[model samples]
Target: MLADGLSLAKMNCFSRKLRRTAPELGSSKNELVPSKLPRINGWSWPLHGFQVVGWLVYIYLAIVSFGIYIPLLPPPWNHVVHALMGIIFILHFIAHIAALTIDPAEAGVRAKQSYSSPVPLFDRSKQSHVIQDLHCYLCNIRVGPKVKHCAACNKCVDGFDHHCKWLNTCVGGRNYWCFFVALTSATLGVLLLAIVILFIFIQHYLDPNCLRTAPQYAGIQGNTTWLVFLPLAPVKTSSAGLLIVAFGTLMLSITCLMMFAHLMAFHFYLFYKGISTYDHIKMRRSKESNIEAGKPPDVKTNNKAPKFLQT
Candidate 1:
């Protein structure tokens, strides 16, 4: 009888232990659920690699055109090459600005905050749809649809893409067009300069005297004249001049071709989709459409969206 009593006591103890542990197991399962989705990390790898390479190539070309080659060229053509290089350089600057301005799509929130109270910290419910109307308690700001706080910029930008390290700024809605245009112009300018340089090289190679002549200076107090245009009239057969032209031309041609190809591809994709680099990265797939017919609908508020957002 004692053994029977002891067995009953052990069973009861086992049941109590299971009951006590059940809540803990349930809590652990809940912890696995993520509060929000991850945002865009940065530029796509291919675009990043391409931009780095292009920048390096353009910088190298700029050095050669402005610092080394142009100063040594003869009158007329020297001035022409210098003018071309200046254009290319200016375009590069524009490209830098464009890269700095963050696109709307690339921008994203670092963290999200939720409040249960009907009173919003910032009145956004009247401006946005229920899903998009959000109040960030940390910032004490109201964010609209597709709006995100950028930690890098320390502010919210609509449709923000990732912060561009190259530009040292965020690429967003306001500056994306300029950035793209700058890139296009820079690429084109580089190509033109490359062609001109290559032509000079080939002409010199065929006729060494084509690039050689009296080195003319164009400065007031010093020998600091803008490199004049290359004297295109004389077609000499100087071996040394031909060699210099050949090497310079080859380098410029290669760099221009590569830049052209890359920009062409970038623009083609941008135009095909009618979206900016920022937008392509952040917009999510339609999750609402995936909901089953019988599932309870998401609670929506009759909120007025921000002016920047699509209706």
Candidate 2:
């Protein structure tokens, strides 16, 4: 009984500290949850399955890079590019998984006051029934400013950004940096994979014997891709090289790699503007409001340039 009481006391003290220290999110309460805030959600079994697929793809990349491609190439292709790419990209992937588990901010909460309960006269605890400053209607806790209630997680997060279906978590506050790093590294890494695959596949054809046949058919060295893009001709189809090329490059090109590219570009624009995606939407709404009110919309085109040159 005594041990449980002590544990409860400690928890209460920690909760008090959080409430006392947490800052306000915004000037107004209603403005807390902006639209399209981080699609980032928390961990779940479904996300675990999603990330597993990414890992499988990465492992396949490694097999294609080291196990299949390098052996076919000359001494020049045996450099440390593959190793470096794996290290950097793997580190970022790990960072993303780690970031997903972290809470952007912790809100403070305490039990509601009960007037019928008598206070202990002998014990001089610092205070009684101290509630948090900002209360979350959803979470039933006091959250700091920038903290918004995540409907998916059913918790009020500090600096609640967005719920990411990929990570299955809300990417908020300091966690966003790691998430961005993950995106950048993953995108670049996939791009590197595409480049490497193209180089190796093209290099294979550079072998003079590749196209020149034994007088049965016309020799074709240059890309006959213009003839038709689909059902890639069985040129060297017997070689494992073709299979690896198709699997590692083509599969990723259509899926993870391409999606990462476009997603990175979108986030880059958001970061350059120094605003969250939600904030961009808010700006658009404000501009529309101005238009509706018959006010001349501020006509500054959001050109991507240095602040000094922008002026």
Candidate 3:
């Protein structure tokens, strides 16, 4: 009877212990499994703060230049300038949209992993590179020679160029053309706007009448110079307003030109060299690493047309 009672007590204790450990065991099991890929809300502007800022800046500049400055010019010239700037802005907007929405992931990765699936965790300890033998560790799939895993996008991009923070996406094989168009349009637009602003500034001093040619400024009499913020309301021109607008336009033009011009020139150089931005960066890093390791860098010579320009 005592043995039976003791055995019952032991079984009850074991059941209680199993109940207590069950959740822990299950949690440990869960830990062993790979976690799902983070949901990348590409359409969410807030997710890409820089992208939002870029859009806002573009809108502000467009409004100030097209709405305010352009209208200050004479009839035909103002209309012509407005039309040209409008076309460039439209091209830029369309290209920007295309670059942002296109998926640049490797074909195999895109085919194998659905949006809902858990991407396999890459084991860096077991591999030297994210891709070895054309196989991606994280994606657990075969990829093309130019495929590279973008840490920012957390996906293997085919023909990876570079991740553009402005577009909040990777620029790769699919969207490279669109990105180039956007860059070109933006650069051109800013340059034209700067020229017009400079012309307007010179005209403001040399022949203020040319600037006030717009129909809205007809009511204001001589010596009481006025500047229009919005079309309907014209306020007497103040030194403060003139300085603010002039300085603001000048700063925006200079900053944007410096950035966009440099970027455009760099991309042109990359094309001339028959390399993508990723390749250039990787080569630079490799060279640096080799120098650090006290190893002489390999030298090779090739006299061939750039891949981009090849027939």
Candidate 4:
């Protein structure tokens, strides 16, 4: 009936550790108390760097598009607009990285032993709601309700959400809000870039003179603009620059915007239903004992999340 090897304070925090470690139930349970584990490694950092570098290049080009490519354009498509877009992109970009790297507040893994459930005051004859909590063999601890054991991290995370390969970490109770905000900001930043690029293309077709990149071929500027690299018309340096902006900034911006939009919408529904993307994708039955059931501690029946998780 005792929590065995751990102290009172340590027992109090044991449930939290399940929400933080790798989820593998097969890991060695030697450590009695949870320790901070490394999130990024040499093998994973390269892929993470790829994501960082790709976004950096895209953001840089979106910012410079205003100053170099189409300065002669009219209001809304001018330096002011470009500067605004750049600022937005930078702000959201920073938010995304910050959320990605921040620890999702891992739980403390404390080994637990055979324990008897306490009786409630009003129902001394009958026990209050029991969540049917499971034992994490790998962590060598009994897991609490809604705490999902990650086999990959070989640790348990409370309010376990999806594993974001981009961040190279699991998104759970601690970082869900930040993850949502990052997706939102990144989407908007890229969308603004797309809008700006689209406007430039529209202006080019309507009045080529308005486009700085419009070809100056024999007093009759052809259909080539920043959006088009080479039409039936001769190629100019400005037009070539426009081509880069077209495929590079515009396409990438729209693609990123669409992806984040879908992600935000999906997560919004998850928030409304009070579930996580992990639950939706895997749809594991949490009622069983084994990890294959993907059993998370069932908090709704009895236990409640902590103050920080509620936030």
Q: Using TM-score as the measure, which candidate wins?
A: 3
lDDT of each: 0.50, 0.54, 0.73, 0.54
Per-candidate count of clashing residue pairs (backbone under 3 Å) = 43, 22, 0, 28
Give the C-alpha lDDT of model 1.
0.50
Question: Could you give candidate 1's per-residue lDDT for residues 1-311 as a string of tens digits?
Answer: 99999999999999998877543422321111212322232342324654577577667766556654564455687788678778767866766644543333322232432212222222232322212245433233566655554544434556554465655455666665666676666666667666656666566446534444444322223221223223333233334554465476567666666866786696578679886554543232122322433433352232332233322
Worst 10 residues of 3 by lDDT: 302-311
Better-scoring candidate (TM-score), 2 or 3: 3
Determine the backbone clash count of candidate 2. Answer: 22
Task: State residue 195's C-alpha deviation in candidate 2, in Å.
Answer: 0.9
Q: RMSD for each model, in Å, please? A: 12.4, 14.7, 7.7, 13.8
Relative to the unseen true structure, what is the C-alpha lDDT of residue 226 in candidate 4, on a scale of 0 to 100? 37
| Model 2 CA deviation exceeding 4 Å by range | 1-42, 46-53, 105-133, 208-237, 240-248, 285-311
Candidate order (lDDT):
3, 2, 4, 1
lDDT of 4: 0.54
* List of clashing residue pairs for candidate 3: none
Stretches of candidate 4 off by over 4 Å are: 1-73, 76-79, 109-135, 140-143, 212-236, 284-311
CA deviation > 4 Å runs, candidate 3: 1-41, 44-46, 121-127, 227-239, 295-311
- Tens-digit lDDT track of model 2 for 1-311: 99999999999999999876643543332323322222223454345566667667777766655554433334344456646676866787688777776656443521332222322221112211112356554334556655654544444556555766667777777588888888887777767666666665666567623322223224434443211111222223344545556565656755777798888888889879887754565566666666877877774345322221110
